[model samples]
Target: MEIILEKTTKPFFKKHAGSQALAKERIGAILEREQATGLTKVKLALRQPVAGRPCFELRCNLAKLGSVRVAFILDGQVARI
Candidate 1:
């Protein structure tokens, strides 16, 4: 499996939550898991948008720096983050 970053909403998503790399890692984990589990495709709706389109939202728990929400898109061997 592979992931393709369509956009880096970090500059915008960071305004509210999570870091770019952190969010990407978390999402990547989930995506990888899904693929391993035989899940072909998935689309998690985020409260944000990418280029006027909906995005997949992710979350992180810093326990110190606080938490954040990441919005991205994922597809077969390619994803947008």
Candidate 2:
């Protein structure tokens, strides 16, 4: 299984530097364990749920993200759907 992450806003990081570091540490651990193969190994990996689950739902204007690459609009450097 692949885990998808939504890019966080810059303002948020600016406000929570210490918390962000801790989060990165925990995330790194999860990604390391998740790299193992097989159901048993996968099941044994450390599991941590997002504090605010489904932090962001990428939705394109009008409807869902379209087939074309243009579906994603770049806001300066940040990409938006």
Candidate 3:
């Protein structure tokens, strides 16, 4: 699976110093769990559709930044964030 961070999301990383790394870690864990089990069996994230498009939200909490919601649409083997 490939993860593509949308262009609009770049600013968030720029504004928050460590958010990008944390997000990556969370995403990696999600993928690992999903691979070991399955998307349906993977927990720790929320599955919510946006504009009728299936989307998943991964929440990351940083000591300095609080919580950030990383929402991505899973299309086949690609994940658009």
For lDDT, candidate 1 versus 2, the one ahead is: 1
Instruction: List all candidate RMSDs to the true structure.
Output: 5.7, 16.4, 4.5
TM-scores, in order shown?
Answer: 0.43, 0.30, 0.54
lDDT per residue for candidate 1 within 1-81, as digits (tens), equals: 354545455355557464555555666677677658764444567566656666665564434446555455555566665
In model 2, residue pairs whose N, Cα or C atoms come closer than 3 Å (at least 3 residues apart or on different chains), thus clashing, are: none
Which stretches in model 3 have alpha-carbon errors above 4 Å? 18-22, 40-53, 61-66
Candidates ranked by TM-score, best first?
3, 1, 2
* Between candidates 2 and 3, the TM-score winner: 3
Error of 2 at 23 (Å): 0.7
TM-score of 2: 0.30
User: Model 1: what TM-score?
Assistant: 0.43
For residues 1-81, write the lDDT of model 3, one tens digit per residue.
677788978898898866676776666566556655666542334455655667666554555677667667766666777
Candidate 2 lDDT, 4-61, residue by residue in tens = 2246344544765545444434433443343342212222112332342211222212
Q: Rate the local accuracy (lDDT) of all candidates.
A: 0.57, 0.31, 0.65
Per-candidate total of colliding backbone pairs = 5, 0, 0
What shift in Å separates residue 5 of candidate 1 from its native position after superposition?
4.0
